[model samples]
Target: MNVFLGFLYVLKIILSSVASIFLMIAIYLLKKLDVFHINLRMLIMHALLCIFVNNIIQMLRFAISLSQNIKCSSHNQFPAPFCAFLCINGVFICMERLYATFNFSKYENENFSYFLAKIYAVLWMILTLCSLLKFWEGILPGRYNNSLNCELQMIRENPLKTQWHLILTLLFFW
Candidate 1:
């Protein structure tokens, strides 16, 4: 089990790093070429960059923890909040895309630029709020187990909330 977990961790780190790199390159090209004329596209790219940063931070914190093994710090202090941001951002994007699909004609009729801008703003505010949830009450530093692994905790700390969020995320994808 330990070996499997270790392998998973290594894979997670590698994949995250590679994703971050590709995302960064894409963002760079977008900015350099001025390809994205739409406000929504720019915001989506910005959110992608945010996730990229989140993944890099997670990888760094995990590496730091593995190397330092500092006894002073608790577990959740490492990468919990950013991890939560990643999950929330993902769900928010998925939900937004769903909404966009359903509201296609409405989006086309109205000035979609401002509409997208509003969604982008609201989604980012929600992401900020979700990330702060950890600082407020969601974080449980001492509890390190399968019930609260790094990925699961990204959704939320409350088991019921986590379960609901997971279901909702899956439904949104569907």
Candidate 2:
């Protein structure tokens, strides 16, 4: 019974991952064209790209980890560095846009100064480097419960830190 259920669980993960990948690709395709040649919020675009790629990687890691022939629960630890960075990057993008929108004088110079745009690009590049530091500090999914249809529980060393980090970054968007 457990084996049958485990098979079903793996199937679900595969299906969901595929669906997510498709959705991400579709979104990318839809945005292939732009109204403006120069975009000020390029950081948001880079962040979104990171997120889409990271999600696919994370999903693949999860499915592979779960499908490993072992019946025991808790097999994977995808650090998902890019995924973690997405939260903070989201806030940064919001803040950058807000600042640019509010202080248009600096960015709207007739000389093609584009100070804000330059800052946005440089900031994302730096943040991308910084995000690499925690590429291996992602979620730890523990034991799959049969009753929960193979749902795994989170087993974290610092749940508070994770929770607070998410909450704090989210606050910036609001």
Candidate 3:
């Protein structure tokens, strides 16, 4: 079991590194591509950035654990928030698409200002942080064994908090 787990960790590290690189390249290309509207492109780039950062953090965590032979829980909180943001970003993208669909005639000529895109990104960041703050509070101190693995299960100790996280995720995803 230990060997298998080690193998999985190595696999995760490699895959995450590759994913982060690809996402970086994709974000660069998106910046150069003129096909997408500015607002939509910004949203897509934000999503990609979130994923890229999350992957890089995960890769680093796994690499540190393997190299130091210690399971560090300190960095565990880093990825969950980004994951939440990605979910929220997905909802924003969907909403933008729906708006365009409903107002197709006006959408073609509509110029969504870059400021609006920045606002949307900031709003999503704030929302994700607020929601995650409560969730993290439930698990951060005195909640579970500090050395135990699988931080996801540790966060589940408080069912109410877990439900809140799930509700938000499902709400955005739905």
Candidate 4:
């Protein structure tokens, strides 16, 4: 089981890194060529940013799980970093989808240049702030597994907080 988990962790890291690199390259190439008109470029840029954020979240989650299992420094690293990533990505996902649904007619009526750019910038800033604040609460030191591991307490011990998160995420996604 340990070996399997280790393999999965490695694979997850590699895949996330590769995807990030690919997305970066795609964005660079698109910008360099200047081939696409304004509307298409805006859409492509939005997609690229979304993909980058999602893969970063996946990488952070994998790191947290592995660090916990190996009894590393989960307090200073795991909960905060992982939670920050989750919060940021979650907000982005929600905002992007919301914009598409709420402002679909705007895009259809006119070019997406102004609207897309503004929404993307606003979403990124909001996500950054939300993630930093939410995860910062778990920055204090704590012990786990009979002091063998010092980390933020598990979600199981704080079901109320976890349940709220689950519900909020569900609502955002749904």
Candidate 5:
């Protein structure tokens, strides 16, 4: 058990390190270009943020196991980092979808800068509500599988728990 846990810890460290590297590159690239020029930046940031969240989640997971005094009893946990990642990522994905549907005409027009900013604000609010539903109200599935040493559970196991993830990964990429 000790060896297995140690191995998992090492794996988590490796994954997080790789993610941090990618995140650094992504941020650097974003600095060099505008948001429109590097749309992939949003996706990369979402992935890195999720990875960082997962690292924190894993630490808390171990700590919860080690400390019997902790009162939280959800066997399937959703740490704050993952929760925040899910919320942020979900909102971004939704906003992206909305843009696709509407063709983002207002955003493309120079005169629509103020309206576009408000659209972003609305997106933030929608994501906040969705995240509250996912995390606090249990609108989405809560049980996350641990078969693989990875961030986010398998879609098969958790279903639409990461609905936005699936849409972006499958539909957008295709």
Candidate 6:
């Protein structure tokens, strides 16, 4: 059992590493092509970049857990904000598409400035950070009260709350 589990873990690490490498290559190619100069493409690239970074973080956390014989659950909190931002980015992408759809004439003729996209990305990051802090407060009261180890269980303990949270999050993202 232990050997099988270790094999599965190693397999996961290999797959994650391969995916990250592919993302890096894709990002490099996109950069070389200057795709980021376009507003929508810039936002798409940001999402890819975030995924790549999140993957790297997960891999590093896994490696650390293996090396130190520590459980990976303790590292869960670190990626929450990344996940939140990715969700928010998806919302921004949709909003951009909707705007383009509504203003097809101007959107097609005008070379939209990347400045606005950059500003939106930065603003979303700030808002996500603030909302995530509040979200944690709601999900796990006394988050800083030496209860870090059990924080994740709070979500699992309340199925209805979790479901509602997911529904609300999806609605907000949409």
Give the Cα-based TM-score of candidate 4 against the true structure. Answer: 0.51
Task: List the global CA lDDT of all models.
Answer: 0.55, 0.50, 0.67, 0.57, 0.49, 0.61
Strongest candidate by TM-score: 3
User: Which lDDT tens digits does candidate 2 get at residues 37-58?
Assistant: 2343344455556556555655
Reference-based TM-score of each model: 0.51, 0.52, 0.67, 0.51, 0.42, 0.64
Model 6 lowest lDDT segment of ten: 141-150
Give a tens-digit lDDT track for model 1, residues 1-174. Answer: 255555655676798789889999888787677564444455557566666766775576445434543222223433334444445656656655676789877754443566666765776676667656643442345533432255365455675543554455335322
Instruction: Estimate, for each residue in 60-161, the C-alpha lDDT of model 3 and write its tens digit.
Output: 656656775654444344445655776777787898899989998889777776666677668666756764674466445554232235555656676455
Q: Which one is best on lDDT?
A: 3
Clashes of each: 0, 1, 0, 0, 0, 0
lDDT of 4 by residue, 1-174 (tens): 256656766787898999889998898887778686556666566556655766776577567657766433233322333334345545655655576679877744555577767866776676667656644543334522221123235454674553454455345433
RMSD of candidate 3 to the truth, in angstroms, is 5.0
| Candidate 3 ranges beyond 4 A from true positions | 72-79, 120-174
Off by over 4 Å in 5: 34-117, 125-168
- Scored by Cα lDDT, where does model 4 land? 0.57
**Stretches of candidate 2 exceeding 4 Å from the true structure:** 1-8, 15-19, 35-41, 71-80, 105-169, 172-174
Candidate 4 deviation (Cα RMSD): 7.0
All-Cα superposition RMSD per candidate: 6.5, 6.2, 5.0, 7.0, 7.6, 6.1
Which residue runs of candidate 6 sit more than 4 Å off their true CA positions?
A: 33-37, 120-174
